[model samples]
Target chain A: MTAETLLTWARGSAFDWAIGIFVFGMVLRLIEVLSLGKKPDLAEGRGSGVKGGLKTIVTRSIPRASVFAREPVRITNGYVFHVGFLLVLLFYGPHIEFIENLTGLSWPALPGGIIAGLGMITMASLVLALIFRLRNPVLRHISTVNDYLAWAVTLLPVLTGYLAYSHAVLPYTAMLALHILSIELLLVVAPFTKLTHMFSFALSRWYQGYQAGYRGIES
Target chain B: MSGPSVEKGINFIREQIDAPVASFFSSCVHCGMCAEACLFYTQTGDPRYTPIYKVEPMRRLWENEFTLWGRIKSTLGIAKKVTEEDFAQWEELVYDGCSLCGRCSLVCPVGNDISGMIRKIREGFSAAGYAPEGLIGATTRAITIGSPMGVRLPALKAQIGHVEKETGIEIPLDRAGAEYMVLLSSMEIMNFPEYLQAIARIMRQAGRTWTISSKAFEATNSGIQIGASDLARELVQRVVDAAEELGVQTVISPECGHAYTAIRWEGPNLIGRPFKFKVRHILEVLDEFREQGLIKTRGKEQARLTFHDPCQLVRKGGVVEQPRHLLDLVAENFVEMTDHGAMNWCCGGGGGVSANERADELRLKAFRQKKSQLDEIGVETLVTACANCRITLEEGLEEYEMDIPVVGLTETLAEHLVEEDQEGQG
Candidate 1:
C-alpha cells in the first residue's frame, strides 16, 4: 500500500482508540481515589490561614525544586526521554496533523532532527533507569514484577517509534502499529500503577499544606 | 574505638535489633520526602540531619548483607565495612537528628516508620556503651537510684513535706489504703517542687484518697527514652508492685511525658498481665477534677499563658484536649502556639536527646523550630504538663535567649487555687 493510504487508515483507528483509552483511564483513576483507605485527620491551626498556605506552596516549593533536578547525567537523560515521549504523543508532525484533522485543533511541530535525536536519547535513558532499578538493592526490594512490566510497557512505544523513524529491520508501518498499540496499553494501565503518583503527589502536597495550616504554621 | 568487648557487645545488639526491627529498617525507599518533615533537617538544611539519613546505617546494613546488590558491592569493594566511625556517625544521626516525632511516618506513603527504626538503632548503641556520656550517666543513675535525677527517698519525702507545710494540707505519703497512687519524677521534686505541692493540694481539695509511694516515687522512665526495654520494664514494675502492695484502685502518672506512656500504656503489657488498676495522666485527672467541680481556680483569669504540648503526653498518649481544657480554664489570655497538640514540635529534649551530649547541636536546632512557633504567638509564659518538657523548653528558651518562662500546667493551676475560706465567698 502507498504511504499516504496506510497513514490515513492508521490515523482513523489510532484516534478512536486513544480517545477510548483516555476516557477509560480517567474512570479507573476516579475509582481508585474513591476506593482509597480512610485518610487520617490532619486538621491544624495556622496564622496566615489561606494566604499563608498559598505563599508556602509557591515560595517553599521552589528552593526544594532541586530535588526533582536529578543528577546532571540523569537530568540530561531524563530531558531527552521525556521530550521524546511527549513529541511522539503530542508533537510528531503526522500525529499533530491527524489530531487536527480529527479534533479541529493543531499545534506547532518540533523539527524532524530534534525529534529523532530525542527518540535515541529517550531509549538510552530508559535503559539506564531500568539498569539502576534492577541492580540497586534498595530499589529492587521496593519494586515488583508489575513495576518491571510497567517500565517495559511504557518504553516499548519510544523504542518502536524510534525504529519506525530510523526504518530499521521492521517496516515503518509495522513499527508504527506496535508503537500505537503499546501507547494504548500504557494509557489504560497508568492510573492503576505507581505511575498514578503523578496525580496523587499534587493531592498529597495539598493535604500537607492544609495540615501545616491547621497546625498554625507556615506551610 | 579500641575496646573489643564494647565492639562485640555493639555487634551482638546490632544483630538483635536488626532481627527485631528488620521490617521497619528495611522498608525505606530514600525518596528524601521525609527531610521536610524533620525539624532537624528543616532547621539545619543538612541532608545528614534528614530522617532518612538517620536510618541510612541500617539501610546500608540491610543492603550490604541482606540483599543482592549489597553482596555485589561488597565483592567489588564499593561498599565499606561497618566500623566504629559508622557507629559514631549513626549515633549522631539517630540521636541528634530524630525526636521520634512520628511526623515522617505520617507523610510516608510506604509507612516506613523512620522514627521506630532510629529508636532501635539507639538501642543498639546504648547496649554498646556508645550512647553519649550524659544519656548513659542518666540511665545509670535511673537504674541505680530509681530516678534519672538521682533524688533519693528522703529528698522526695522532704519535697512532699514542704508542699504540706506551704499549703497547710497534709500530702499523703505511704498511706496503707489509698484509693489512688500518684507517681512523681525526681525532676519535679528537685526543680518544680510546686508541681508536687499542687498535686498534693489538688488531691486534698478533691477529697480523693491518694498516696505517694516512697519506693517508686519517681515516674520519669529514662528506660523508655534510652531504648532499654528491660530497664523500662524494671522501672514500670516498681509502680506495678507499689499499686499491688498499696491495693490502690488507680495509678496516676505525674506530669512527665514518657512516664505517662510507660506507666499507662506499656506498664500492663510489660507486667505480662492487664493492670487491674486504672492508669491516668495528671492532665486527665485535672480535667476530671474541673468537670466534677472538685477543684476551683480563683485567679486563673489573670495569667497570660500559652501551652506547649509535650510530644509523648499529647501525641503518643492522645491526651491533647484534656490539657487544653484545663489550660483554658486557668489562663484568661490563653493563646495556642503555631504548633500545639499532636502536631507540636518537640521541646528538643525528647527521646533521650536532652541527655545525649553529642545531640546538643541538633537539640538546639530542633528548639529553634519551637522558639519560632512561640515567637509567632507572642506569649510570655509557656505552660507544659510534662516535667521533661518543662526542663527542655526552659533550656530551649535560654539557648535561644527568648526570656520565656516555662511552667508546669499544674503549677499554673495551683497559682490560682482557691483556699477553703476564699471558695465560700466566691
Candidate 2:
C-alpha cells in the first residue's frame, strides 16, 4: 500500500488492535502477578507497611545515596531516559492529542521544540544505556534476549518520532506511520516482556519497602 | 533431566512463589544494579555473583510455570526448564556468595527484594540436598544436639561456672518467674566467654532478675541458616516453651546476628503465633538499661574505634540505633564507617557463610570490602554487637595482618560499668 494508505490503516485498525492487546495483556499480567497473593505477615510490625509502601512508590525514583555514588552513570542515565521519555510521551502535542482522543483527558502540551529536544535526549540516553549494558560485565552476563529487545522497542518510537518530525529517514507519511507502529509494537509486547516492569516496578518496590518498614527499616 | 530431590526442589520453589517473589522476578529489568550493591560482586568482580542471577533456578521455574507466555513457551518446549544441574550450579551462589545482607534489596531501582529471593531460593537448594556439607552438618547438629555448633547444656553450664567464678556473681539457670530470659549463641559460649561475664555483670548492676534457660540455651538457629522452616520452627518452639515456662517478660537474644533475626523477626511466624515474651537483642537490652539509668558507666576507651553493624541486627532486626547508643557510653573516640548503620557492609560471614567451611576463601575475599572500609577510617578497634561478626572481623583482620582488635559492644560497655564502690564515692 502507499504510505498514505499505510498511515490511515495504522491510525485506524492497527491502533485498535494494539490498544486491545495492551489493555488485555496488562490486565492478565497483573492478575497473574497479584493473584499469587502475599501471605499475612504474622510478625509484629514496628512501623507502618502502608506508609512505607507509599513512601517508596515515589522515593525509589531517586537512587539511594550509597548506591548512586557507586553507579552514578547507570543511575543518572536511568533518570535521563525515564524522565525524558515520560515527558515527551505525555506532554508532546500530538501524543497528548492522541490520549485526549482516546480517554477524553486534556492537558497543556510542551512546546514543540522542547519536546523534540527531549526526544533526541531520550534517544541518545537509550543508546548509551544499550552500550553500557553491552560493555558492563555484570550486565552482559545477566542480560538475556529480553533485555536487548526491551531496549530496542523502547528506543524505536523515539527514533521514529524524531525521524518523522525531521522528515529525514523516509517520506513524512511513511515515517509518521512507522512511528505510530513502533509504539503499537511496544504496547503489544510490553506485558509479555521485561517491559512489564513499567507496572510491576511499583508493586515490587512497595512490597520491598513494606517488608523493610515492617522491620522498622527505611529501604 | 530430573531426580526425586530435584523434583522436590522444584516443588519447593513453586511453593515459594508468593506475590512478593513473583513481583520481584517479574519486575527485574536485568540492569544488574544489585551487583554493585553486593560485596561478593564488588570484591571479586565476578559477573556470576550478580544477585539476581544467583536466583536463576527459581526465576526459570517461575517463568516456565506461572506466566502466560511462559506457559506457552513451556508447552512449545522453548522455555528453559529448571534442571538438577541448575540446582548444583546455584547452590554455591545461594549459600556462600550471598550473606542475605539486604543491601541488594535496598538498592534495586525496581525495588526487587533480591536478597529475600536469595533466601527463598536457599529452601530449594537445601531441599534438593545441594546445600554445602558444612550447613548440612550444622542443621543435623542443631536438630539433634540443640546447637548448630554442637554446644550442649553441659558446655554452657561449664561456661556459666567459669563466668560465675570470674565475675563473682551468681549465674541463674532455669529460674522461673524471672523478669528476663537470656539466650546464648554457641559461638559466644565457646569462643567468647566474656560476653556471658558481661551479661552477668551488667545484669547484677542493673538489679534485674534474669535467667538462662537450660532447656533452650542455644540461640543460633541452624535450621534458619539451612532454610528449613520445619526445623527452624522446632528450634524456635523450644525457646518459646522455655520462655513461657520461666514466665519471663522478655527473652534477650545474645550478641549474635542470625539468632536475633531467627528468634525475634522470623520466630513468631515460624512458630505460627506471636511470642509470649518480647525478644530483644543484647544491645537493645543494654540500651534500655542505659535509658532507665540502671547501668552507669564511668570512663571511655581512648583508642579510636568504629562499630560494625551486623546485617541481621541492623537491617533485619531493626537494632541499628541501640548499638550506637550503647557504644557512645564506652567509646570516647568513636568513628563511623563510610556505610554505617542500616546500609553497612556485612562481615562477609553472615547468613551461615561462617558455618560453611567450604566458603572460607570466598568469605575472606569478600572481607576485602570490610577491610577497605576499616582502612579508610583506620580505627584501632572494631566494636560490634554480633558475636559471629566479632569472630569474623577478627579472622579477616588477622588475614590482612591488620592490627585492629575486635570486641563485642556489650563487653566494652560492661568493662566501663561503674562499680558499687565507685558509684557510692561519686
DockQ of all candidate complexes: 0.05, 0.82
lDDT string, candidate 2, A33-123, tens digits: 8899987777767898988887888888877788889889888999899999999999999989999988999999999999999999999
Best by the DockQ measure: 2
Deviation of model 1 at A191, angstroms: 19
Q: Lowest summed lDDT over 10 consecutive residues: which window, candidate 1 chain B? A: B18-27
Model 1 docking grade = incorrect
Off by over 4 Å in 1: A1-219, B1-27, B63-82, B421-426
Candidate 2 wrongly placed segments (more than 4 Å): B421-426
Q: Report the C-alpha lDDT of model 1 over A1-219, residue by residue, as the tens digit.
A: 665555555556764676686666555544433333322322212243345335434443232222333234533554556566777668778779867987899989887777778777777778987776676443454555557777887788787777788888577876776666677667666654545544444343334344344434323
Q: Mind giving the per-residue lDDT tens digits that candidate 1 earns over B340-425?
A: 66667777788778777777867887788888888888887788888888888887888778887788888888777777663322
True contacts kept of 1: 0.00
Give the Cα lDDT of each candidate. Answer: 0.68, 0.89
Clashes per candidate (backbone, < 3 Å): 6, 0
Clashing pairs in 2: none
Best by lDDT: 2
Q: Write the per-residue lDDT of candidate 2 for residues B1-426, one digit (tens) a residue.
A: 799999998888888899888888889999888999899999999999999999998898888888999999999989898888898888999999998888898788889988888888888888889999999999999999998889999998899888877777888999999999999999989999999888888888888999999999999998888888888999999999999999999999999888988998889989888887888888888888999999989899999999999998888877888888887888889999999987899989988899999999999999999999999999998888888888889999999999988888888988998877533221
